[model samples]
Target: MLLGFQDRLFGLTGSGISVESGLATFRGAEGLWNGYRLEDVATPEAWDADPELVWRFYSMRRRETMAVQPNAAHRTLAAFEKRLGDRFYLCTQNVDDLHERAGSQRLHHMHGTLFQSRCVLCGRTFADSGLYERPDSMPKCSNCGGVVRPQIV
Candidate 1:
């Protein structure tokens, strides 16, 4: 089915677009991360109860995401977008910024973005510029002075 897509001028993509870019799919038997369950750390309740642990997990993921570059598939889609302009649309479930780094101007993040943080109190979202080694340091919301957490989904 993918081979047939090459001739088409416009198309949509999913998680598959990022798999080749070194992002792991959070399914299957081997999908577990460090023996921790996804539900335990990837929920609003988890953040409310233990924000530090949740921040640790997301911070490590952000570090890994920062290490990888966009692969051929991402670059191809970017080139396609350049050729098709507004006719092409891209929707990605992966949170890494590879698609954006690959020059994809027309795209949407269905799940969320890894490089963004949100305030737990007021629910305000913003870009995270700090590195992962500083996980112990909590980000304060410029709007409400509340601690901010990464908005991972």
Candidate 2:
């Protein structure tokens, strides 16, 4: 309770919240991820082994994330944050933008974000909503002339 824990820190830990917004879980019964394994697309080693494949995987994820809107639970969390202000905090494992779209300001993406990317060579990150379906179409980092990768943790 807020009153009971007024002198202590209160926070919320949320995992798998993105699934309620129609996004698939990483280890769910999905054909693509389960068939390929998470290491092939979610790790820095995987990106080094095959950057193109990684791009393709994240591109698909970005498209799917872009298609869905925040669910009622996400909206409720956002509303709750507005009410609780600094007393409430949200940490999520989901990479989707559902929480942000729902208007949550006191939230932290524990995994990373699907709508943003970073440069492996320069460490510059930017908002990227465009689908890079083709490997050749993947944006190049303007700062270092290196391949830009998804900014997910």
Candidate 3:
């Protein structure tokens, strides 16, 4: 018996796969969990309580993520996708663009992405590559003048 395309080829990845690319996995012994608490930056309440801190945190992350490049494993996966074409499917839990940068177009980002921002009020999302140099420089929603937040899940 043979399986269909969707069932025949599948790829799933997470932060661990990109850890080799110099990105932190946030779950290992040296993960960010040791240095920062989720309550301080990962929650909506935290954002409301101190948006500056949140912005700073994300700004730092954006800077860090932008500095790194996709690793061999990432490139390999992308090549595999090109070879498999529509038969290949990828799902990632990472917020970085290593996979995308690696050239994988048939992929789904399960945890959202770091380079995208969403407007809190209008709920519009746009691609962002610029580092938020300062909290004050954070971009605002053009549609509703609302605060823009990272589009990560």
Candidate 4:
């Protein structure tokens, strides 16, 4: 369709795309819901009520994400981006780093990223791949000294 009329492509990826990489989908057999509920660790109120607990939940997820690699689906999308250049747009609901690891430069993480943290007050975001070595240690925004939360939806 590049020369026909519409000369662009849009690709949307979700948790399923990362499942083949041995990662759990949101509602799959090995999903996060197996042990946790949204109200307990995936909601803003949950974070507000117990930041530590929320952090703990995400920390486990970070560990799991780190252990896996990008699967073929991720690589295919990256290849499409490479071939199409600006003509292709990719938006993903997954918060993992698989797509980026697969070399997809032009991507939009609509659900936020797992390895990133943003300041709730200052709204500044930066890469944070640490597993927070110390207990009771939470990231703080350097600008306004606000609490940093996971960049996930």
**How many pairs in model 1 have backbone atoms within 3 A of each other, for residues 3 or more apart or on separate chains, i.e. clashes?**
0
Q: Could you tell me the lDDT of residue 129 within candidate 4?
A: 84
Local accuracy of candidate 2 as per-residue lDDT tens digits, 28-116 = 76645636887887798998898777888888888888899988888888877777678778877778888889998787878788888
| Best of the candidates, TM-score | 4
Clashing residue pairs found in predicted model 4: none
Candidate with better lDDT, 2 vs 4: 4
lDDT tens digits, residues 96-139, model 4?
A: 99999999989999999999998999899999986753556887
Better of 1 and 4 by lDDT: 4
Provide the overall lDDT of each model, using Cα atoms, as 2-decimal numbers: 0.77, 0.79, 0.81, 0.85
lDDT of 4: 0.85
Report model 4's TM-score to 2 decimal places.
Answer: 0.88
For lDDT, the strongest prediction is 4
How close is every model to the real structure, measured as TM-score? 0.83, 0.86, 0.87, 0.88
Tens digit of per-residue lDDT, candidate 3, span 23-84: 77756565454367766777788888977677777777778888899998889888777777
Model 3 regions more than 4 Å off = 1-7, 28-35
Sorted on lDDT, highest at the top, how do the candidates line up?
Answer: 4, 3, 2, 1
After superposition, the stretches of candidate 4 with alpha carbons farther than 4 Å from their true spots are 1-6, 30-35, 133-135
What is the lDDT for 141 in model 2? 86
